[model samples]
Target: MGQGADHLTSNQAQVLDHLRAANAPMTAYQLLGRMQNDRGAVAPPTVYRALKALEEAGLIRRIETLRAWAPVATVRPGVVVICDDCGTVRGVEAPGLLESLHERLVAEGFAEARKTIEVHGRCGDCAEDRA
Candidate 1:
């Protein structure tokens, strides 16, 4: 993780640490609050700059729907999963999933640029509670 921080500025490292410690996804504003509360001297622009660096490094993902972010698990490859019901986000490893989809798109004469897979439905706890 130190090596990852080496590529980022001090502020970015701090932001990444906060995101990694969080139990749930956090918005940039939430991160800014955390920085201000914890560091007591950090500025808002610092938080945003850090977030941008982490996003560029693929060390974290921004949840478009919720406009929040969650740390990428060390064991998982880069994949984002968003829960529709509670708006919780999780990361998983589905290595070839995107590649296969892109291939199929090309076969159908459609050029795929970017793809965001948002599976909408109740999460396990929510489903069980409803049942």
Candidate 2:
């Protein structure tokens, strides 16, 4: 939820703000540049620290496939779709069916499904370009 922004550490808030504005996943180095351009110089470790904190808080998520990060618009269960050709990333909220599946998994002895799924493919733009 957007209200959770109030609970983040200063650096985490800054990173989340930047990624929310970005509207797409970004690598740590790219975020570093954005931070420097917007504020004064910042170290990579500082950004990584903020990122780890934000990830743990569910305020943001990492696209492990791309090694990039993006802000989580909502805390609800969802999936990350990535454009394999252009590296574009989009987060989609899972429908009720997926929720039901997760519930079934939990019933079958799985832990609460907090992990978001990641799917990679050529996005519409890239597909159209190929055509």
Candidates' lDDT values, in order? 0.71, 0.78
TM-score between model 2 and native = 0.76
lDDT of 2 by residue, 1-131 (tens): 46454577778878888887784688999999988998898999989999988878768778777788877773234778877787667777778868797889989899873665888888889989989
Candidate 1 lDDT by residue in tens digits, 1-131:
43343466778777888877876688888888887887677777777777778877767767666777777663234466666766666666677987787789999999876566655566697788789
Candidate 2 — which residues are off by over 4 angstroms? 7-10, 74-76
Q: What TM-score, computed on C-alpha atoms, does each candidate reach?
A: 0.75, 0.76
